[model samples]
Target chain A: MSIFVDGNTTIVLQGATGSEGSFWAQHMIEMGARVVAAVTPGKEGQKLHGVPVFHSVRRAHAQHAAKAAMLFVPPRFARDAVLEALDAGIPRVVTIADGIPLHDQIQIRAAARAEGAQVVGGNTSGVISPGKSMVGMFPYWIERVYRPGSIGVMTRSGSLTNEVTAWVVDAGFGVSTLVGVGGDLVPGSRFAEFLPAFETDPETQAVVIVGELGGTMEEEVAEAIRDGVFTKPVVAFLGGRTAPSGKRMGHAGAIATGSSGTVAGKVKELEGAGALVADRPCRVGELLARVVQ
Target chain B: MRLLEYQGKAVFKEAGIMVPAARVVRASENQALRDEACAAARELMSAAGIGRQAEQDPTGSSGGETAWFAPGVMVKAQVTSGGRGKAGLIVRAESPEDAGQAAVAIVEREPSVRVILLEQMVDSACELYLSISTDAGSARHLILASAVGGVEIETLAEQNPTAIQRVSVDPFMGLQPYQTRGLGYDLGFSGELVKRFAQVTSSLYQVFRANDTELAEINPLFVTQDGSLIAGDSKLIIDDNSLNRQPQFEVTREQYGTDTEYEAALEGIPYVQFDGDISLMCAGAGLTTTVYDLVQFEGGTVANYLEFGGPNYRKARRAMELCLKNRSSVILIVTFGTIARADVMAEGIVGAIAELKPDRPIVTCIRGTNEEAATETLADAGIEPLLDTEEAVRRAVAIAKGEQV
Candidate 1:
C-alpha cells in the first residue's frame, strides 16, 4: 500500500477551471486516479474531461464522497481554497501555488493541524503514489522515472525529485510513494510528517530524502531518525553546500543564515543519526541499492 | 527584499511607531556629498533642538548631563550587512564636528555604504528586545520578547536561551491583546508599562501584516527616563512577492547597492554573487543549490548562483551576461526542467552562446521534458550535452581549474 494516495483514492479538484487545473485534472485521470469531482466557484455545472464541476468543495462532496483534494489555485486565493477543502472534511490536500505569503501558510497549516488533516504544500509540485494515483504537476508523460516500486522518495525540489527518481528507476528500483514537500520557508508538511508513514508502509523497503539548505527541516529529519521514530533504512542528499552566506537562492527558504541551516551541519547530523547520506543524486541510488538488500 | 535601516524606519514611522528623528547623509564621490554631510550634521543638531552654539563637552564625564547636541546623536553606518557595532561603524557624536567626521569615516571604510544615518539618541533606562518573525519550524508568526536587548537576538538565544519568550500568533485571530500583555509580563513589565508595551507590540504586528513584512524587529526597544517606550532601532523586511503593492519600498534595491544584485534586479533573475571562479546556472533554486554543492564538493568554487523560472529566455541571456561580466573561469549550465521546458532553456543558452561567444569553457547538462529537442538545439549550436550530473560536475571543475577539455 502506498503512503497517501493509491488506486482507491477518490480526489476532488479545486480551481478546476483554470488552465493549469484543467491540464492536471486530465493528466491525473490519464494516470488512473479517480477524479470524482471538480470545484470552480464561477464555473459550476460545467464538465472538464467528462468530470463534473461544482461551485464549492462542499457542493462537490455532497455529490461525490471525495476524501482527498488537489488545489491548483493561485497564491492569493490558495488560503481560502484550502480552508474550503478543510471545511468540507477533505482529510488531505495538495496545494501547488508558489509565492504564497508566509502568514497565509501559517493559517493553512494551523487549520490543517486542528482538523487532523494534511496540507502538502503552498509551493509544492504535489505527491504521487506512482502508477497508482498521481496528483500534482509532475510530468506523467515520462512514466519510466516513476514506475511503482518499494522506495519512498520525498524531496523539497520538484525537478530534482524527478532527477533522483530517474536514477532510482534506472537502478531497478521504483518509488512506492513520492512527496514533494516544497521549498517554502514554511511548507505545510515537513519531512518528519512523511518519514513515519514511509517507515510503516509495508510496500516501502527504503526511503530517500532530497533535502536542501535552509530551515531546520533536515535537522528535524535527523532528530526523528535518532529518536527511532523512523526505523527504515534512509538515504539522503542535501544541496547548497557552495552557497555563500546571507544570499537567498531563489527559494524563499533555501538561504542558510545560521548554524542550524548549514549543509555541513545538516550532513553531519544526518550521518550521525545512522542515515547514509549521498554526496550526489546518482550516489543516492547506489546507497539505497546497498541498504535495501 | 531586505530594506535598509532608514527604509525600514520609514515604514515603521508610517505605521505610527516612534523612532529617533534622523537624517541620512547620502554617499557621493564629489563635492555634492561633502556639502550634503555638512548640511546633514546641521540638520541633526537642529532636529534635536540643540543650537550650534551649545558647548562641546569632550570628557563625557557626566553621562546624564546634556551634551552639545542636547539629547546627543548617533551616527550609524548604513550598510546592508549587519553587525555594524562590532564592525566599529557606529559612533556617538556629541557635536556637529564629530557627526561630520563619523559619517566620512564610515563611508571611507565601507565603499558599498551609500548613506549614513544620524539619529537623535535617546537616554534609555532599559533596553528591551521585541520582534515579530516567521518561524518555519512552527509554521507561524512568532512574537519574541526579552528584557535583555542591545545584543543580537541570535546571540542571546545561544547564551541565555531563557531570556527570550516566544509566542506563536494565530493568523486567523491575529495577535490578541492578551498575548501581547502576556509577553510584556514575561519581560517583567507591570501596570501601565505592560499595557504600553502591549500597544507597541500590537502596532508592530499591524506593521508586519500591513506591509507584508517577512520580519519586523525593534532591537533595543527603549524605556526612557519618563517610562515611555520608543523603538531605538527598527528593521522591517518586506516580502519580495508583496513588493508590487509596496511601490514606496521598491527603491531600496538601488539604495542598498551591490553590482550583482542591481544586475539581477534589472534582469528579473534571482542571482546571488560570490567570489568563486565558476559561473553556475540552473533552472530551479533547489537544483541550482544541488549543482552549487556538488561543484564545491568536487573542489570547485561558483562565481554566482543563477536560476531561471518558466520558459523565459531573456532571463537566461541576462544571467549569461552577468557571469561573463564577472569574468568567471568557467560556465556550468545544469538544466533539469520540470515545468520549464528543456528546449526553451536550450534555446536561451544557444542564443546566449551565439551572442556572447565566451572564451571560457562552457559545459551543460539537460534532462526531462523535451530532452530530445534540447539536445538537438544544443548540438546544432555545436555544443554537446552532458546528462550525468556527476560527470558534468567533474568536467566543470576540471575546466575551472584550467584543465583542457
Candidate 2:
C-alpha cells in the first residue's frame, strides 16, 4: 500500500562493486531490504555480501526477475546503467550516483519518460517505503524509529530526512514512505512524478515535503498542490534558511539559477499555494503534529 | 557559475555561433582601455558596412544621416551574471567619446567590468526560444517559436502555449530542418519565414549538441535587421560532468556567495555570520535546529542554525567563532551524533574561548554519545558538559537575561 519500494519488489543493484554500491547493498540487507541481485560488469559470478552478482542488469533480471533497480554507478555510466534497467523491462529505477553530465542526464530522463519508467534519481539518495520495504541507504537509526503509517515523507537532503524522521518517529507517527529524491539539480524524478503514486496509495493520509534552495521543483510541486492532486493534509519544510544566496550547497547542479528557486521564496510560494509550510526544520514536528490529527 | 558576458560570448563562439563584432580588452590598470574602446567602435562600424573616411574624427556626425550605422550603437557592460541590463550594465552610446567615457567609468569604479561589447544594435524582425533541453522526461531538442519575441517569451507561452509551437527532435537526429519547418507551420509561419526559422533552429541545435550544453537559451532568438535569423542574448549553462569529454572547456568556476565568506570558510557549509550569535555547535539539520528550537521554546531567540557536522569539535569551534563575530549573550554548544568526539570537541571550544576572552556567558554541552568517560577531559579543562541541547540553550538564555541555568 506504500509508495516506491514495498516488501514484494525484487531489486537489483547497479554498480554493485563500487564503494557506494557495496556500502548500501550491505546496509539495505542489514536493514532487512530484499537484495535480490547485484549488477557490475567484471564482478560477474561473484557475490556482494552473499547476494549473487551478474555482469549486466539483463542477466541479473534473467536470474531473479528483479522489477526495480538502484544505480550507484558514476555519472558517465548512468545512462547506460539506466538503459540496461529499461532494456531489461524493469519498470522502476532509483539512481543515487552523482556527477552525471547534464546532456547525458537529459537523455536518461527522456528515455525513462518515453518508456514510462519511474527513474527516481540520476543524482539521488533513492526511495524508501518504510515498514513494507526499503530500497536505498537511509540511516539505520532513523529507520528503526519510523514505522509504516499514513505519512509519505520526501526530502531533498538524504541526511536531513533522517534527522526529520528521527523527530517524526519520536513523535509516534510512522512513515508510509521516506524518499531522498536526490538534491542534485538534474534528478531523474520530480515531485510531480511521485505525486500520483502518493495520491493513489490508500495508506497515505498526509505528506511531509522537505525541499532545499535551487530549481523550480518545489514550485512545480506547489503548483500541483494548488491543482488539487492530493486531498490530504500536507505539512512542508524548505531547508537552507541560512544558506548563502547564489552558492550551491553541494552537488554542483543545485545552484539557485532562477528567481523562484531560493529558499525564502519557495516558502512564500508554498504557503501561498496552500501548503502549511514550516519556516525551518525545527518547526516541522510542531507543524505536522497539528495537521495529521 | 556566472560567466562574464565576454566569457559567455566565448562559450557561444566556441560553438561557432555568430555574435556581434567584439573583443574584451583587459585594461583595468591601463589607459589603453580607451584605445581598445575606440578600436571596438571602429570594428562595429566596419562590420555594418558603414565605412568612415580617413582623417575624419570618429565622433563627427555623418552628415546627420539618420540611417547611419546598421541601427544604432550599443555599449554593453561585460558581466558574468544575467540581468546585467537590469543592473544598467548595457547602454547605447551616442558617439565614440560617450562609449569610451562609459567604459572608463565602468572599469575604474567597478573592477567587475572587464570589457564592453560595443556593436551595432540590430533590429529584430522577430524573436524565438530556440533551445535544446529535456522536456516531458525526454532528452529533446526543442525549437519553440512565437510571432512575439524577447524576455516575455515565458509569459507568452503560458498565456498561449499552443501559439508557441514546438518541434521536438530526437537526441540522435537533433533538430532537423524538416522538423523545425513543421514547428514553423504550427506557429503560423509560411513562405520565407518557414525556411528562416528552420535554418536557425538547425544551426542552434548543432551548436548545442556539439558544445555539450546542459542548456542553450537564445531568448529572443533574433530575426536580424538584415532579414536573417541570428541568436540574440545567448545563455548557455555547461554541465560539469561532461567537461571531462571536452577538456579544453574545463574552467574552474564555483559559486562563492558573499554570505559569511571569511576567507578561512568553505563555500557549502551551514555557516552564517551573525552580529549577535552564540558559539553554538550541533550535528545534522535536526540536531542543529535544536539551537533555535530549544532556545525559542525556553523564551529565548537563537541567532541562527549552524551545523559543524560529524562529532568533530574543531569544526564546531570554527563555526562558533564565525557565528560569534559580535558575540551572543552566551555560547551554548551541543553535539550528539553517532561519531561522537565530545571530549576533543569540548577541548577545542574551551581552547578557542580561552585565547579570545570577551564579556559573555559560555554554556557548553559536550555531553552526549561517547563522552561518558570523556568527563575527565572536560574536568581537566575546568569545564562541565551540559546534559542536552535544551538545558544548554535554556541556561545560555538565562545567563543572557542575568538568570541562572
Candidate 3:
C-alpha cells in the first residue's frame, strides 16, 4: 500500500487549462491515476484530455467525489488555490508552483493546520506512489526509476530526489511513496512530518531522506528518530557540503543562515540519533543496502 | 537584492519609521566626482552645524570640533558586505575636510563604493537591536529583539543567549500589540516605552510586508537620551520573486556590478561563478548543489554554475548563453523537469547551441515530461543526451578530465 495516493485515489487537477497543468493532467491519467475532474476558472466547460473541467472546486466537488487535488496554479495564486482545496474538503493537495512569497506560505501553512489538511508544496515537484498513482509530475516516461519497491523516499530537493530514486531503483528497490516537500524556506511539510507515515506503511521497510544545508528540519528528523517516533531504518543523503558558507547554493532554504543550517550540524545530529547518513547521493544506496539488511 | 544603508533608511523613512538625518555622497573613479563627493560630505556636515567650527580651527587646540568627531556628523561608507564599522570603513570626522577626506579614502579603497553617507549621529542612552525575518523552521515571521545592540547579533547570541528575546508572530494574527508588549517587557521596557516599541515593531512588519522584504533589520535601534527610539542602522533585502509587486525596488539590482552576480541576475538567470574547469547548469537548488558535489567527487572542476531560469524558455536560453560564454573546458547541463518541461528546456539549449556554438564538449541529462521529444530535439542539433543523471555527471567529469566517456 502507498502512503499518500494509490489506485483508489480520485484526484482533481487545478489550473488544468494551462499548458503545464493540462500536460501533467494527461500524464497523471496515463499513469493510471483517476483524474476525476479539472478546474480552470475561465474555461469551466472545456475538457482537457477527456477529463471534465469546472471553474471552481466547489462545482467540481458537487459533481465528482475527489480525495485529492493537485494545484498547477502560478505562484501568486497558489495560496488561495491551496485554501480552496482545503475548504472544498480535499484532504490532500500538492502544489507545483515555485516562488510563492514567504508570507503567503506562512498563511497557507496555518490554514492547512486549521483545516486538518496536508498541503505538500508551493515549490514541490509533487508526490508519486510508484506503480500505484502519481499525483505529481515525475518523469514517468522512464518507468525504470520507480518499480514499486519497499523503500519510502522523502526529500526537499526535486532534482536530487530523481538522482536518489534512480539509485534506489538501481539497488533493486522501489519507492512506496516519494514526496517532494519542496526546497523553499517554508515548505508545507518538514522531514519529520512524513516519517510517521513512512513508519506505519508496512510496504516501506526503510526510509531514505534527501536533505540539504539550511533549516533545522533535518535536525527535527534526528529528534524523531532518537525519540522512537520513527522505528523504520533510515538512511539520509545531505547535499551542499561543498557549497560556500554564505552563498544560497540553489534553494532559498539551502543557505547556511545560522549554526543549525550547516551540513556538518545536520549530519552530526542525524548520525548522533543513529540514522545512517551518506555524504553523497551515490553513497545512499550503499548505506541503505547495509542498513535495511 | 540587498539595499545599502542609505537606501534601507530611505525605505524605513517611507514606512514612517524615524531615522537619522543623512545625505548620500555619490562617488566615481574620476577624481572630479571623488572631489564632489567629498564636497558633498562637507556640505552635509556644515548643514548639521559640526564641520564649520573645525574649518575655522583645524588644529583644534582651542577646543574645536570636540578634538575627534565633527560634533554631530558621522561619515559612513556604503557597501553591501557587512562589518563596515569593524573594517574601518566607517569614520567619525571632526571637520568638513575630515569628512571629505574620509569619503575619499573609502572611495579609493573600495571601488564598489557608489555612495558614502554623512549622518547626524544620534545621542543615545543605550543601543537596542530588532529585526523581522521569516523563520523557516516555525513557518512564521520571527521578531528578534535585544536590549544589547551596536554589535553583531551573532556575537551577542553566542555570548548571552537569554538576552535575546524572540517572539514568533502567527501569520494569521500578525504581531498583536499585546504580544509586542510582552516582548517589550522581556527587553526591560514598560508603559509608554512598551507602546512605542510595539508601534515600531508593527510599523516594521508593515514595511516588511508592503515591500515584500525577505529580511528587514535595524541593528542598532537607539534609545535616545530623551527616551525616543531612532533607527540607527538598517539592512533590507527584497525578495526578488516579489519584484512584480514592488516596482520601486527595481533599481536595487542596478546597484550590482560586474564583480558580483548582477550580470546573470539582469538576464533573469541564476548563475554563480566558481573557480573550476567544467561549466555546470541545472534546475533546482538541491540538484545544483548535488551536481557540484558530484562533479567534485568525480575529480572535476566547475568553472561556473547556472540554474534554469524558472519555467521560461527565453530565460533558460539566456542562462545557457551565459554558461557558454564562460569558456570552460566542458559544459554540462543536467536538468530534471517537474514544474518545467523538458521539451522547453531542450529548445532553450538547442537554440543557444545553434547560435553560440562554443567549441567545447557539452553533455546534457534531459529527463521528465516529453523526454523523447526533448532528446530528439537535442540530437537534431548533433548533441546526444544522457538519460541517467549519474552517467551524465560521470561523462561530463570524464570529458573535463580529458578521458574517454
DockQ of each: 0.65, 0.29, 0.59
lDDT of 1 by residue, A92-195 (tens): 99998877877778778888888999999977789888788887877766766778899998889877777777888888899899999998877888888998
Model 3 spans with C-alpha error above 4 angstroms: A42-46, B51-72, B251-254, B298-301, B312-316, B324-329, B339-347, B359-405
Per-residue lDDT tens digits for candidate 3, residues B1-405, read: 678888888888777677766777677556765566557656665555663332222332221222222355678877777788888789877666677677778767776677788876666788899999987656678989999988777778888888999999887777788888899999999777787788788889998888888889998998755456778888898876677777787654435644436767766666787778888878767887888888887788888878873454346556766776665888888876655678888888888877877788889898765778899999988898888766888898888888876
What is the model-wide C-alpha lDDT for candidate 2?
0.64
RMSD of 1: 4.0
- Scanning candidate 2 chain A in windows of ten residues, the lowest lDDT window is A251-260
lDDT of 2 by residue, A1-293 (tens): 88877877888888878775787788777766777999888878998889899988888899898879988787788888898899899999987665677667677777887788878775555777765566776544434335667788877664456555655666667888877666555677777668878889888887888776667777877888889886677778765554545544444434554354576777777788777887644566777788777
Better structure of 2 and 3 per TM-score: 3
- Which 10 residues in a row give candidate 2 chain B its minimum summed lDDT? B59-68
| Counted clashes in each candidate structure | 0, 7, 3
True-vs-predicted CA distance for residue B127, candidate 1, Å = 1.6
Ranking by DockQ: 1, 3, 2
Q: Which one wins by TM-score: 1 or 2?
A: 1
| Clash pairs detected, candidate 2 | A110-B137, A110-B138, A110-B139, A124-A182, B3-B80, B4-B80, B313-B345
Where model 2 places Cα greater than 4 Å from the true spot, the runs are A130-132, A142-150, A199-203, A213-229, A240-275, B14-16, B43-73, B120-129, B136-143, B152-173, B185-190, B252-405
Query: What is the alpha-carbon interface RMSD for each candidate?
Result: 1.6, 6.2, 2.0
